[model samples]
Target: MRIFLLFFPVFFFCGLLHAQTVKVEYGGDPLPDKDRKKIEQFLQHEVDFYSQFGLPDTLSLQLYVFENRREAIDYLESINVSLPIKASGAYSPKLQKAVILGRENGRERSLAIIYHELSHHFVSQILGKRPPSWLNEGLSEYFEHCTIHKKAVRHTFTEYEQGRVRTMYMLGEVNLPTFLK
Candidate 1:
């Protein structure tokens, strides 16, 4: 009984390491310290916004930024999932990590994607359940680009998603009320 009790604590601590509330591991690509700080600041702002809005408390998620899609995909595939065909960034709730393309898309887009994934993480906490694919995707796209201007918050939609909505509106496929609901 003493042997089992001692080993159990060791196993529990090991599990805790994989579930860090906050961790960001950079790859060999060498992200500049300036960029890293900016990213952290943006993420922290998101966390604060959600907390102030009466959502669940903040969550700690590990972030992995690789130099390119290949590296990201390789690392992702090493996990139990299949390779992503054309993804730049993603949040794996099961793993509690965000995997992203570090160098390829440049800072603006990369930051947008990171915010998008992190938004998903928080939104999941709000619903306390997995949202439908469209809701998950729409909310993420809505949060992908956030800007504060003169005490006003603006959210920019992804180009593809925005274009689709515009096209639908033009074609009378969607009306304001239907879209809102």
Candidate 2:
């Protein structure tokens, strides 16, 4: 019993050391260092948020940004992600990667896409398998609203969105059976 107690703290500290780590790799067009650092910071915020649900020992993320939709589509296809005609971003769990269609002037939208894709990665890490599309896409949609402030990250629906959801619920438009199907 004394030996067990002696090793317990060591094991606990080791687990904390290996808790979780995230590495980001960029491909295709070169990302500016400033933008890259911001993206990494946002990812770190997301990693910390999702850590409550548990994570793997290490998470390696590959991010590919393409200036053209065709190239992004082709790249995602090569990795076996069959994106629809108008997908702006996609995450591949098998490759631990995300491919995005870049818009030079849309920084806010770009961050939203990054957050959404990272949510998919976290969900995969937690569940070890894909959940239903409704749940998966719903989570991504909700997480896309996250904004990284200087001191914090925040994700919340606007009042309009809250009203819309409330109206939908009041009208019984939120069909759980069909959604779960």
Candidate 3:
């Protein structure tokens, strides 16, 4: 009877673990092991980042890492049943998940996209609410320029590529103000 009582609670607790478990469903082009590990680590960090705010749950999030933006957009459009943003990554509120391009120029670019999308999920859960769209997106962008050192994440602001920016502006490129009418 003593053994039965002890084992029964353990068995019940196992099911609770299943209920809140996070599952990353992968589709599209095959990714190298290196990229896959990066994705997993970033996702784990995102959960820990938000959980620090004393959320009741562990901030479970699903990540879908596509080999390119096309595959990511295709996945989003199919599930969203609406036009998906044509971008490196996006967070889906309906699915409570993140879909992102796993590689572009390099691992750093991919890491930036991962952080940007993951931040969206983090802010919403950590604060038990979301900030305005502009603030949320700005925060994500700021976090995108981040570095992980010895398990510590540090965000750094980088100026836009100096040489390229100067050349483009010299060649008549302009920064137009956003006009929403």
Candidate 4:
């Protein structure tokens, strides 16, 4: 009877946890509906842009827009990642999320940051949470640049050849054992 009573609350609490909806807050400049619509359009463009690289279609993405760097830092602090930049924007793969901090005063800058973060999101999804650190960071940088230039392949290969960036070989072996380590 004591065992059953102890287990009852555990099961009840688990049920309640599963039934909860996740609420996300976006801090920054308040985006008007019209601007938000434009942002969505830019996101779609990024999607198409990344698709050219043979990225999988199963990856899902969400974007949160913040008004400025301070608000972004505040929100990021809540999630426990260090803020290393004045950051026009940032991405969080664990949350399956990207955040754009600051307004789209212009299309080019806004779209660039969005595409960069979206690239990170997709890479995280494709690698199934066990990709190599170098590959992960390199791919994210590659996609960020590609989004900026609308290129199919960016400077990654060249950068690797020139020693400007670490090669996949130096990134360690591409096996699960090496990668997960």
Best by TM-score: 2
Q: Per-model C-alpha lDDT, please?
A: 0.61, 0.70, 0.60, 0.52
Off by over 4 Å in 3: 1-27, 81-86, 127-130, 160-181
Q: Which consecutive 10 residues in model 1 have the weakest lDDT in total?
A: 1-10
In TM-score terms, candidate 1 sits at: 0.64
Looking at model 3, report the run of 10 residues with the lowest lDDT sum: 1-10
Per-residue lDDT of candidate 2, residues 1-181 (tens digit): 0001000011111335545567667786665566666677677766766676676657777777766667777677677887856667888888887777765538677767878887888888787667678877887888888777788777778788878877887899987566446
Which portions of model 2 show Cα errors greater than 4 Å? 1-18, 156-162, 165-181
lDDT of 3 by residue, 62-176 (tens): 6666666666666777786343445677777557677765476687787788788778877776554556888778778877887777667766646664566566667868452
TM-score of each: 0.64, 0.74, 0.61, 0.50
Clashing pairs in 1: 21-60
Model 4 per-residue lDDT at 169 = 50
Residue 178, candidate 3: alpha-carbon lDDT: 29
Query: How many clashes would you count in candidate 4?
Result: 2
In model 1, which runs have C-alpha deviations exceeding 4 angstroms?
A: 1-29, 52-54, 147-153, 157-181
The all-Cα superposition gives candidate 3 an RMSD in Å to the true structure of 12.1
lDDT of 4 by residue, 137-167 (tens): 7766665554322333333233544463244
Which candidate leads in lDDT?
A: 2
**Sort by lDDT, best first: what order?**
2, 1, 3, 4
**Which 10-residue window of candidate 2 scores lowest in summed lDDT?**
1-10
| lDDT comparison, 1 vs 4, better candidate | 1
| Model 3 TM-score relative to the real fold | 0.61
Better of 2 and 4 by lDDT: 2
